[model samples]
Target: MMFWLAFMLLLSAAQRGDAQWDWLTGIFGGGTTGSSTGQNDPNCGVAAGSRIIGGQYASQGMFPWQVSLQNLAQGGSHGCGGSLFNNEWVITAGHCVDGMTNPAMWRVRMGLASLQYYENGEQEFTVTKVIMHPSYTASAMGFPRNDVALMKLNRPATVSNYVNNICLPDRDASVGTNCVVSGWGVYDIQSQYFGQAPLSATLKWTYAPILDPGYCSQNYIWGSEMVSSIMVCAGYDHGQDDACNGDSGGPFICPSPDGSRWELNGIVSWGEQPCGAQYKPSAYTRVTAFKSWIQQTIQSN
Candidate 1:
C-alpha cells in the first residue's frame, strides 16, 4: 500500500511540474530549445512584446531579428538595417548591397539596440557571400525594383534571448494592416539640413499602415512605373510615420494573421526626401514576392 501511495505522489509531482513549465512558456513565448540554424524551429518570431514608430525606443529583445548592416570599409559605419532570416542568412534591400557586393567589406551586428554603444548579448558576424536578386533593377532616377538581397554569414548565429530569426510570411498582409518598422535611422524629419541629419544612436520604431497599391502608384512622382506589383506601400496620408534614410533594408514586420507572432512582410526600400511627406508613403520590397527566390537561393547555395 505504501509503495502504491509513493508512486502516485511521484506521478502527481511530475504532472504539476509540467503544468508550471507550460505556464512559463506561455508567458515568455518559448524556452531555449530547438535548432538555431534553421527556420523550421518553432521559436522563430517570438518576442517579449509587440510595439514600434510616430516612433519610440524599443526595449532590448523586443525585436530580436533586427540587425545593423555595417560597412567595414567606412570605419564600421552603419549603412543599412536587415532582418535575421535564419542563423546563417540575413535579408535586406538590393539597393543597400548594390555596387557594394564585396563580402569582406561588411559586418552584421545583431542583438543590439544601439549603434553607438555596446550592449549585452551583442553578436557580430563577418559576411561570406552577398546575393542580389537576378531581376533587380534601378530606375533612371536611382529607385530600385525587386529590391531584395541576402547575405550569408561566415557561420550560423548563436541564438539566445536577444537573438532569433523572424518568420517569413506565409501570405501577404492585407491593405490597412498596421505593421512595425524599426531601425536606427533619422527620427526628426523637420531639420533644415535633413540630408545631413544624424542617424539615431538608439533604435527607433513606428507604426506604418499598409496602403493600397493603386493609391501609392497614383501619388508617386513616377506614377505606375515606380509602384510595381512587387513592391508594397506603407505609412499614412499625413506622413506622420515612415521609414527614412539610414533605414533602408530594415524590416516591415506585422503580426501574423492569428496574432501568434511577428512576420517579416517587407523590406524598407525607398521614400521621398524629407521623409514622412504627405501622400507619399514609403515603399518596401514585398517579401512574399521573393519567397521562392529566398528559399531556393538559400537551399542551392
Candidate 2:
C-alpha cells in the first residue's frame, strides 16, 4: 500500500510540478524517487535561471563525466543522473535500475547540458548491461542498501571536451572537504505552491561540505535510521543546496588537494525530508568503500 501510494504521489506531484515533492521523504518513510516503478522528471519544470536547489548553471564542458539516464522503455524521457566512468561504463545508484533491470529499456545521454535541447555535441547510446551490487536491498522505509550500480554502454564513447570520465576516490572522503555536486533536479524546494516553478533543464552545480559521520547520525533527520559507514553525508550548515528526487545516481565530486583534478567520491543516494532542510545533509554511496567491488566487477565482467 505504501509503495502504491508513493508511486501515485510521485506521479501526481511530478505532473503538478510540486516544488516540495521530494522522493526521499516520508512518502515511503524514506525512499528515493530513483525507483523504476515511479517517475520523476529530468527537466520537467525548470524556471528560466534557477538551479538545483541552490546551485548555479553548470558551464558547458565543465562536467564531462555527467550523464543522463533515460527510460526508453516507458517513454524516451530522462529518469536519473549518471557518471561516465569510462568509455564503455557508466555509474549510477542501484535503485535507479532496481525495478527496470533490462538494459534494453535504458539509454544514456552524454555531452549535453540543456535537457530541453539536443545540442550539437550530444550523444546517445543504448545500455548493454547492468551490474548492481550483490548486497543491494531496498528497505521497507525506502532506504536502499548498497545503493550503487554500473551500466555498460553498447559502444565506447569517443571522449571529448564535453564527454569524459571522472577519477574515482582513492580513499574515504574526508570530513570538512568541500565537494561539487551537479545535476538537473528541482530548481528550488521552498516554493510556496506546486507548479509555481519549473524543474532544471540545464545541468546545475553546487558546493557541499562533507559532514562528520557522527554528527550526521546523531544530529540529523534520519538519526533513528542508522547511518551506514559505507555512506558519506555532506551538506551545508545552512542547507540551501542539495540533491533532490531526480538527482539520484549523480556524482558527488571533490577536488584534489592541489586542485588539479576532481575525484568521484560519492553517488547521490538519498536525503532528509523537504529536500534540503537545515541540519539535514544528503546521503551518498561512498565510492571509496566500493573501490574493490567496482574494479572487480569491471575486470571480471
Candidate 3:
C-alpha cells in the first residue's frame, strides 16, 4: 500500500504528534490550540537548519587525518543526522526512521557539539538495522526520492579525540564544489524551537543549485510531482535557508574528485516550504545518484 500510505502520511506528519492541524495538511485542524503551537513553536513546516564551522570533533587541519563528520554528531538527540559513513556507520533520515522501522529504535549519540539532553552526556549507541534506500518514490516528499539512510551500529565505536568518519561521495562527487552543510539544525526561522540550534551552514555550490529538469517540474507548489531521474535541488534562490527539521541525515559536503578529503555529496533531502523559502530551493538525495543503491544496501547488510 505504498509503504502503508507512507506510513499513514508519516503519522499524519508527526511534529511530535499529539494533535493539531496535520491530518496530512488539513491545516491546523485537530485541537489543543494547534497542538500547543506545534508543541511550543519552531517547526515552521518543511525540512529545516543551523550548523556551521565543522564539528563532531572536527579536525583534519593540523593532522589526525583531517576528521569531522561532526565527530559523529550530536543534537536534540534520537537521530536526525550525523556520522558520514564511518565510526562503523550511522548516517540518518530514512524519514528519521519512517514509522519507526525498528533498528532498536536507533540510539546513536556521539561526541556532542551541542544539545546536551542531560548530564554525563555524549556517546550512546544501539541500532543494528534500518537501511531504506530502495529508491524512494511516490514522487518523493518534494524531491525526496531515495531520501537516504543507514545506521548499523551494534558494537563498534571507540575512536577517540571525539569520534570520527566523514567521506563518502566520490564517484566524482561533483556539482560545483564549495560545500559543507553540517547540522544540529536551527537558525531562528521565527524561533519555534529553532532546530537543534547547534547550528552550521556554508550554503554555497552556487548558493544551492542543482535542479533543472524543467525547473523542478515548473517550480514548486507541488511542481507536477517532480521526478527527473529521481530528483535533486539546492537552496537560496534569493531567500530561505535550510536543513530544517533537526537537519535530516546531514552532510552536503564537497571537495573530492581526488583533490582529497570532504566528500558526502548529499543526504539532507526534501525542501521547498519554509526553512529557506524564497523561490523555494533546498532539496537533496543524490548521493552520487544513489551510489549503486548505497553499495547494494550496505552490502546486503
Candidate 4:
C-alpha cells in the first residue's frame, strides 16, 4: 500500500510473522529445537545445511534466494527474506515494518519453501501498505541504527516455481567492498544442530572483505562512526560465520558492475553480534545508501 511502509522494518532482523495472512506482525535459538545439547548448538540446524553461522558461504544458488513472508503486519513475527524489486516492491530491512501505524496490520506471504511447512508453491498477499525510513530507528534493543525497510503489496507478487528477484548493488558500488548474502538462513553442519527447513542451502557462501561505511566503521572503532552511512558490513575473524533465525530481509549482494557485475548491495541489515561467529561483522543497509530513498519510496508508491 504505502509501499509496505518503507520495507517492513524488523532489524532484530529477527522479527517475523505469518498466520496465513491474518494480517499483522511480528524463533528458536537454544534448547529443545533438536536437543543433543540442542543438537550440537552451533546455533542449531544440522544437515539441512546447518543454520545461522553467519559467515554464510559455501554456495551454489542456495534455493535461488528463498522467500516465504506470509501475511505480516506485526514486526517480522516470523517473516523475513525479501529481494524481489518489481511487481510491487519487496526489498526488506526497515526493521521489518517498524511498529505498524496500522494499515489493517499488514499481510504478505509470497512463494514459500519453508517458514514452517509449505511445499507445492506459496503465495499470500494483502499488505495494503508499509514504507519505512523517515529515518528508521530500531527505537530500542541494542540500538542497531537506521537499519532499513520496505514492503508494499496489496497486490503484485506471483512469480512462479522457485520465487525470484535478487540483484542490486552498483550506485558506483564499492566502499571497501565484498558481497553476497544468501538466506533461508542458519548453518553449522557436520557435528549437527541444524534447524529450519527449505533446501538448496548447499551451504550458501560468500563473506569476503565486507566493508563499507567509511571503512566498515572500523567496527565500532568506538561504536558510532561505523553507522557507515546506514550500514553495510561483513566479516571473517578466524572462526565459523553467521546470520540466523530466518535470514531477515535477505540480500547483501554486491560485486559491482565494473568490479565484475552483481548489483543489489545491501538489504540484509542487522548484525555485529550473532551469525558468522567472529570479529563481529554482518551489517547491511547501504543499498547504494538508499538510492534516493529507494527512488523516493518506489516512485511515490
Each prediction's RMSD to truth: 14.8, 11.4, 18.3, 17.9
TM-score of candidate 4 to 2 decimals: 0.30
Candidate 2 lDDT over residue span 95-211, tens digit each: 889978899999899878888997876779998889999999888877788989999888777655466666676676579987767787765766413644345778887777798
Please report how far candidate 4 places residue 193 from its true position, in Å.
Answer: 17
| TM-score of each prediction | 0.85, 0.79, 0.31, 0.30
**CA shift of 154, model 1, Å:** 1.2
At residue 80, what lDDT does model 1 achieve?
A: 90
Runs of candidate 2 exceeding 4 Å displacement = 1-55, 191-198
lDDT of each: 0.74, 0.68, 0.44, 0.47
Error of 3 at 295 (Å): 7.9
Better of 2 and 3 by lDDT: 2
Q: Candidate 1 has which clashing residue pairs, if any? A: 53-205, 53-206, 53-207
Worst ten in a row by lDDT for model 2? 3-12
The superposed Cα distance between candidate 4 and the true structure at residue 65, in angstroms, equals 13
Model 4 stretches astray by more than 4 angstroms: 1-87, 92-121, 124-182, 189-230, 233-241, 244-266, 269-277, 295-297
Runs in model 3 deviating more than 4 A are 1-69, 72-89, 92-107, 110-114, 119-123, 126-151, 156-183, 189-228, 232-266, 269-277, 286-295, 299-301
| Candidate that would win on lDDT | 1
As a whole number from 0 to 100, the lDDT of residue 156 in candidate 3 is 55
Model 1 residue 117 lDDT score: 84
